[model samples]
Target: MKTLRFVASVSFGKDSLAMLHLLLEQRRSLDEVVFYDTGAEFDCIYRERDRILPLLEERHIKYTELHPAEPFFYQMFAHPVHSRKTGGVHKHGYGWCGGSCRWGTTYKNLAIAKHLRGYQEKVVQYVGIAADEKNRIGDKCYPLLDYNMTERECLAYCYEQGHEWLEDGVRLYDVLDRVSCWCCRNKNRKELKAIHDNLPRYWERLEALEAVLGNMKGKPLNEVVSCS
Candidate 1:
């Protein structure tokens, strides 16, 4: 049998970070550490990601940055816009995610798996959904659920060494409980308002997106960006 490659999927979230720590603590080797940059995440997420990168390198782990064929906006939204007047790069063939317009996490993982499979013989992926987040768990989950790490513990472990979740964690955490792609329609009014309050430029970007896309359904495209 081919040796199974261990790959950890991190989104710069508490659970994923904790999962990585658990793997390291057990001395399990990681063939790859992947972060999918949809280019839609909040600025803080990228900042937090920068801080996490060096730490991984310090441990001799070389991380991978993955991107979809196009930026998240083009693939997820603009391409699917029904009207020609919208004016954005898009194709009219397969149906898009639609409505929610939230980029799928499954797609992100699939991208990593597909890219690695071309070069590697076998791959075993480690997902970071915490034990407490049962709703987020599904098949091929090898990190948090298998190891039984809870969300609370994930947060605690990531913060244990101080320096703000190993540095810069607190900066985003102080402003947002859990940073995600700032434009996710799942974000609540509070989160949208927070974006306006904290990052005015980003708020303007969302407003511009709204102008181009118009109502996602009942509200502007930006309204439903996330659940938060």
Candidate 2:
């Protein structure tokens, strides 16, 4: 019989980080930790990874970073797409990932899933969903929910352990609800306004992409933002 290998997937978000922390605290048999990089994540996400690397090394846990074969801009701006409806090829890449076209997430998931297939042992995947998010909990093992941890409690626990998402001297969780991809269209107006106000460099990149893409969520980027 093949041995079971426990692998944890972490996005470095509060819930994921807390789940890893709990796994460590409980002395769970974690063989590996996988992180999928979209290549468009916020600087803070990378910083958090740096903070956690030493700990993973100390614990002798295998740390694997998976990335899409194509860069984010290439996939979003240059990749060719077939148009069966028009019977013609669309020269431009898929626009901002929102509504029904979340190509970015699709790419991330495919990369992670493909990497997981390489394991010879039976893989037991661990997700970071919290107890509060029962709707998102599927068949995957969620250590956070198993421990009865809520999102707020997870964030608090991460802060207690000196883990934070900070960019430009600004605490990200203080402003945006999520600290994932800076260019994700799922971000709401409030989150966009926060980015425009706090992170000008990233905001500039957003503006440049918007210039090429023309609009975000069916309206012009500036019009969609229109921050006062």
Candidate 3:
């Protein structure tokens, strides 16, 4: 019998890293590792990527970097829908994404999943949903093998693998969460505040997109957000 062909979606976060570590422990051979990048991601993300590159190099893991066909920021400005909210800040007018409304605009997340679907053989996608965040793990459209391990388990796996120095003396269990774009709607109150405080220009642009749309009360994104 042939071994299963699997692709591990690596986010360079604790959960995803843990999933990869678990696979390595099982002595499984991964066909590939996929990563999606939207141009608007944070500088810290790039630094993290730098750190991840050597780790992948050490492990000789094959990975692919997939970016959007169209530039996300360019599309944001070219369309009228995203144009109107150009400079406003604050969640009310600025189009910041949160729990109720995600701005319906996560290009990278879905794009990565879609790209994974095109592989030649049957693919088992491994997602980094934590045990504490069971709700984050959902019925994926394609074939998926999910493991909802806890944050503690994720860090412990890394520590067991001799990555204690990489933990940066930070409490791994508490700091094992993923980092994403500053203006992303999936963020919590603290994340939003951090964006509003640090990246005012980006925050303003998001607000402008929302102001242009005018319906913050759970309306369909198609009606409010138009690519044209």
Each candidate's TM vs. the true structure?
0.75, 0.95, 0.61
- lDDT tens digits by residue: candidate 3, 107-216: 66778768866766666676666778666666531111345467777767766765432222333234223455544556544444444455556556556665665533
| Sliding window of 10 residues with minimal summed lDDT for model 2 | 219-228
**Is 1 or 3 the stronger prediction by lDDT?**
1
Better of 1 and 2 by TM-score: 2
Q: Put down candidate 2 lDDT per residue, 106-157, tens digits, no spaces.
A: 8888888898889899899999999989999777798887789998999999
Off by over 4 Å in 3: 1-3, 80-106, 139-148, 152-178, 194-228
- How do the candidates rank by lDDT, highest first? 2, 1, 3
User: What is candidate 3's CA lDDT for residue 72?
Assistant: 56
lDDT of 1 at 202: 70
Model 3 C-alpha lDDT versus the unseen true structure = 0.56
Per-residue error for 108 in candidate 1, Å, reads 2.1
Candidate 2, residue 35: Cα displacement in angstroms equals 0.7
What's the C-alpha lDDT at position 61 in model 3? 75
